[model samples]
Target: MKKLIQFYLFIIFSIPCFSQSFSFEWTKQLSSTYFAEYIWEIATDNDGNIYGATDGGGIQTFLDTTFDVATSASSTVLFKINDAGERKWLRHITNSENGSIAVDSNKKVYSGGWFIGSSSLPPYTLTAGAGFGNSSYYTTLDSLGNFTSATKVFSGNSFLNSIAPVICNEAGDVAYIDNREFPSGFTYIQYHTLTKKNSGGTSWTKAFTTTDVVPLYIDPANNLYIKGAYTSAITVGGTTLTNSGGQDIYVAKLDGAGIYKWVKKIGGNHDEWLQSAATDADGNLYISGYFNSDSIDLDGIKLYAELTENNSFVAKINAAGNYEWAINLDSNAYHFAMNLLVDEDGNKVLITGRYTEEMTLGTDILTVTPDQNIYVARLDLSGNILSGMQITFPLSATIYDRKLISPESMLICGTFSGSVAFGDSTYTSAGGDDGFITKINFCELPATYYADIDNDGYGTPDTFTTACNMPIGYTNNSSDCDDSNNAINPLALESCNTIDDNCDGNIDEGLIIATITPASATSFCKGESGILNANTGVGFSYQWKKNGVNISGATSSSYTATKTGNYSVLITIPGSCNDISDETSVTVYNKPNATITNIDATNDLCFDTSIKLKTGNGVGFTFQWYKGATALAGATSNIYFATTSGNYKVKTTNSFGCFKMSTPYTIIKTCKLGESDSPNLQVLIIVLVALKCQQPIQLLKIVNFGNQSL
Candidate 1:
């Protein structure tokens, strides 16, 4: 048996939010081709997959699969789809009203709602008390969309009932709020119960008194938070709070073990309603709603409502359940702050709701048509509006649920009449209001970026757009010649890939180098030159280098090597593509010395006498003796004997085939006078052949001293 508890009721208000630069990635429409379906709520799993719970159902087609929903007015439809809008499965819960759906960290989904008479969820069924009796039931399914189990929580004699969304934390703990009724004496008494099912399948129930208390959220630590409006005094966990105005807003917390933590009440002299609440990773709480009170007190801080109609307000509370700050959004007409979500770090908060006419927050004004306007705004934890945007529909539209996939991305679901634009495409409803889910990205002052399809840091200018901060698969450098290949970028190195790896116009230009003409080492004698030519190609430029340094005036295909060093040529193509050929080592040797000397030391001799002459240092050399300018016959040896007088010279050629000429040597025709021939000096014919003398010639004036005749 379940224990009865008091109930607290809170009224929900609608308000407009702020504005900012918002871009939609995709939009999905859900409804029958001929019938209308209103998407009441949406939830996401850890994989970013979405689950929707709706009523007033119809059929829908996603991808290649078709889902034909039941036509019952009370039939509840539950469908699952991936983050990219690809449908997975759809289920029909017959004889049941709409419900709220949620997913745990493990992707397990839970949903709870009311059903009339006899309702069934496949193999599981629930029976009411009698005629028109309504019962609250909770059912769970695995991530694959298979029903696991169902439990009947409460049954009512009448259909008048209220239920909150089923929420689960990462630890698999689930909680929800439901109205339980029992007969006291005559009529049945209505009571609100808070039910918690732990991961281990343990269950606990607690009740609240005289107010509309709905289970708002459950944090990762399994802490449960409930919010509603209370009049006069309200008590929780032995602590009591007295209202400061007609109806005050209150939020209470319970630990995973069902122990009360604290309760916070916020109000003014007039009525106030709390529409939505959310918590950050640090357990900090942020709430938003509308207050008609001229001024509302949040802790010791005071915030005054704007305009004569209901004004929207958003506030923050620390982990200790203490108020931090509160601010009001101004609008001349009725406005209500509907939904609020905060980042885990508590740095940003997003609020979404409906507004009429115009609404302003800080310096931003969200002006919409006279009909219901949907506004979204982002604020810092300090309660300052960073940016905002407004969405308008020609007829009527409402955003029922929103989930923050990250600080920069969100998923929103709702129902709208008429047509709505998503990105560059427009989608119209099928007859009446149609359910829709859209994914939007929040960006900070976007800039144009090109698509780097190859992810090479360089992109193609052919595909570009203004989008979020350095979006994935995009870059600011648009200099890639081949966007399909990562190796072909502006900064890539030239290789043998045949294509222009460095984005240069020429393909494999520098890589194809012409080898030096004489591929092997070459040698030449001193004072001689060697001609070296490079293999030529069309449009090819050349620069010759010596000893690894560029040689002046050596820019042709052929170069003259006049000195000894390592030589190479730079073969180039236009557009800075070039390569240096392998070095050709050159060696130059000195020609053998080519001087001639007299061997016998006798240049003046009589007839029939001869002298010998030789050239200097004759190793590895070919020598030739010359008379005047004519080559002497048989003078090719390194040594020569001169029998006649004439100007004589020697020419030498080294092993390297280089030649050098020596100075001329001369032998004069002369006679040496003997003692017996000196008497008749005037008519004597002196024969001085083969004579060796210290002095060769002398005047014969001694005739009178040797004979006495003159």
Candidate 2:
């Protein structure tokens, strides 16, 4: 099944973007009526076929026959043409000849504006029955120029007023703005109303009372963006837009539910008004407007513009309303921007406007052949002009709408008088003021050649990869005087001590060696910071390096050396004729100034006592306590405890990772005896036993040891 899903693209008449090459393809003049006629807008589909809304006789009648507007007073026409300027089909729908047009992804065309008398065309039939009348009409046509649907918006009771720029995001999801004057003073104050709807029958509408409104756009998210001109301070959606001066431009954004997001006012004190506004795929808004003020304040950055006449201003505002960039296209006499577009990536920007007299773009000044001319410029998103041209035709012409059909082609349409010039060929007008379709073809970036300077790189506007990728000594890098020398490359470091360090083909351009006092001592304590001073000289820049590596932010005349290493200062005058100072050797002594102090007051060991030795603590210093020739286990702090005394000392390492040991101190000890060693009683007992034995021997002769008892 063919899906009915569709998307309506904001047709931006795109020119050759980054590629500075362009040429006119073909031009075809269109006409259908003897009366004054014009094509208001143009668009293109995926196939590159040209389509637009016009009020001329270029289309066929309702009966599928060629239109003869010779008898009809005025007619509204929608047209489609091939790349070769050949018309595929034309449809005449109404008599009232003013409206805007848009296209969708399926190549379905939509044309809307104004019409009088019940349009006899299908779907545009009178809402008030068959009768001569006026109304606003919106019609859709397929790629084959077949009518899909037509809608008569309003008729009978009220004449169609003014239409704002219409935004149709996709099929069945469209948001449009229009204004009707309310009953007020002698002046007609426009009260603009916005109507939003989707295919699912969701609908929302909002009304803002303002001076006048122009471009209205809808982003992919269905958020509505509006542009209008105001005379005084007016508030809309609870946000106030104050007039900067005579007239100021007002822009506001609202969500799908009609909720206000942000409102911004632009312009300062002179008369100004924006013609149109568009959003890139990322929702960054690009606005084109004309101003007469000497300077325009974009958000806060003030841009001084030459207002020789009315100058055109193109601005880029991010989604949050932050001003990115803006510039003034000085148009000599009068100018008005018809359209503005930014590619999806927000890199390439196309601006189309009508200017009289002459306009200077970058270095190219273009003077129109006669009266006014149509101009298109390709610029960066920042409004920097890269390349542009004067797309012109004799008499007067201006492109109303445009679309980039391909990378190298554009579809443009507008009304022209007399004849339209397409490069070498010119096509005369079919009748009165006829509509026109033009094709502009572009080519890829032209090949560029650059000389490899210093045999290292080539000279091109781009970086090394873009233009110098080809095999050779050629490079895309630029401005090399010595291509044969490898030291002449742009990346080569220029030094004041040597000649031509930078490969820019200039010698000693900015070389100025600075003279200063070197440190008296190359060695210092770990906590000490070494000072390096350079002498003052004219036309010199200084870069200090440590061990051949550039020190970040070390560009001053004097440098404090924190770490010990080989230090050198590269000094060069204006041309980078660098004169490097002799490299100085600075040694950092990190050994712990580990001071081991015998904090113990007592040198002699007493009963069951321990002593602790002390050492002063400092940065990057860790100490280990020792006793004579043996290291104390688990004694790594500045203080150590000695359970049993011996020769004691401490070892410490400083910031430079150096270690030192302290002299040893000794502790003396003396032990006393106890009372358990007595033996007097045991000897006395032995003597008694010996005596008894002797007595027994004697008593054996005298009463059996009676003497022993005594």
Candidate 3:
């Protein structure tokens, strides 16, 4: 039997995979002659298309011709298949040792690998990438597998590019940390450096004196993470990291611009080789590798590794790069290759690898029957094998690749030999040791249901349950306006609320809920306006009314009342839940209206004679008299006297507390009395003088000078 390897497990394995969650669904194999080669990574687009990234040799299997030409790879390759396995398209990339694959939001595919350029036509000249020259290659293809951009990168300096993994973020920013072999004095030193390039051709490269750096992931935010093993001491960003003798692993976190955020090491007093790592949607990392040491330290915690063979171990680190837990899987079997994947929800982890002898997890152990058999396990975040699942295929499996189709489903691809049984289905090798793709659903979550004890069309808002399906008298709706009454569902009309009047997920909401903004009576002066605002509950419309009549065009939260009346509002809400707001009577008091009505002025009478004027009779109100526009001094009563010729008016008061002025009446002085200039007393004066004029007779008809009478 051959070995088992299944997941680069990054791309769509965004979920956390648990060891006990791996269940065999259906496996289909395409024939391939060569095995035990090439590292694989896979991803899927929004359209459910599956694409695999890895180098393959020999004959490629076809799912009845999924793609165009219908042929496998003779060299480096990118294989794609539809979600239904109805079609496929595989392209032969240049000779690449290790490669990575990704899909952008635009469905554009990117593929790259380390070591470019052969001695022939030159592998760099044949490869494709966005920014390629000679040493490395990067290529892009449209959603339909049409070639777009290609570039091969070549080195001109002393720095050498290691076969580190590459990552392409959702923004299309490509990033990697390749080992740079530079000569310092007599010997060539090995150090790692991170390089990042933007789609617009902007680039930045940062170098560190660390050894064995493997770039793992680039988040959509362009954050990069690299993992590797170290021997001695290495300094990064001026901080030196010393291993506990022998070998250890280090992980570096960097920003999109090649700026170092932090670096951490994980290992012990032996040898540890980091083959691969996968991150959940939360950025929590799950690393898969083999260590030959006796005791190793994970973060600050110490762990003991089984001493017999090369034991494969998986460790988990939080987003902050702190160790959470680690487990030594298959300590008895020598590991050839392995892949790890974490579900997107970060709750489960799936590990695919090869082993011999036996597999022990917790209390459950499965022995490899006869010889070497492919092993796949599922685990939880706490590193416990999930219940009900343990898979060990009969044939040899290696270079595993996995993509999570959803939170509950996963797609696995790898090369296998002979015949393998997955669940109840078995797929035989098409020809030689061929590659296979399997779909698995290993998730279990409780379903949510609403309680409907009354067997009504709706359920009570406060009651619920969890089950795989709706039970008897239970529904998926919680919008029962009344739980006790079957007539009161979401379709019921809202009425007066002794209980829920309408089944709109609310009780007595808009009904009987007419809140007035101004809670009491108020007043407004005449010629001014008053505002009345009604508080209608949510999702309610308002119509304002004056007295008993609805005011035209007065539909809103508040109404501007131009006239005096009892103001109220009617709120009409959806579901026929309506209410009439409280009444707010606005007393519009009128200003004083004063009119000068009965002005009894003795104006056109005797000249020099004072005239008495009286105001017109009116209700209880004070009055004043005025001469023209100015009020007469001390003439604050209902009557006034005019002693001189002038235009005058009197003001009267009414019950409305208003003042009114009458029309003005003018008085004039006609003439002044004067003594006659020459009193010509005729003879009667002499005789009357003696007689003393006692008879009062006197001179009648005395003639004065001119025509003046005396």
Against the true structure, whose TM-score is highest? 1
Worst 10-residue stretch by lDDT in candidate 1? 1-10
Compute the lDDT of residue 292 as modeled in candidate 2.
Answer: 79
State TM-scores per candidate.
Answer: 0.65, 0.54, 0.49
Candidate 1: residue 42 Cα off by (Å): 2.0
Taking the tens digit of each residue's C-alpha lDDT, what string does model 2 give over 1-710?
01111112244665444333455556666654455456666666666677776665433232124557536546667777766656688777655566567666667666665556556565446443233334565666777877787776654443234343455665535666655543346654556666776545787877766555543676777777776677788886677777677877777787777788887777776877676677787788887777777676777866555554477888888888787888776644556665677765547887777777677776666676654466677778767887656655445665555566765566666667777666557766655666666676655453344655445653534334222113243454456645567765566776654466575666555445445466556677666778887766776578888998899999988888868898888886654456677787778776565565656777556643766667888877877878787788888899876667588888887765567788776766544222234322111111123354434453322121223221
Please state the error at residue 351 of candidate 1 in Å. Answer: 4.1
RMSD in order of candidates: 10.8, 22.1, 15.4
lDDT string for model 3 (80-121, tens) is: 776655557766564443556777667778776554444112
lDDT of 1 by residue, 614-647 (tens): 9875557888889999998888998888888788
**How many clashes in candidate 1?**
22
Ranking by TM-score: 1, 2, 3
Segments in model 1 whose C-alpha atoms lie over 4 Å from true places: 1-19, 56-58, 62-64, 72-74, 116-129, 160-163, 180-190, 231-246, 280-282, 299-301, 329-335, 344-395, 449-465, 469-710
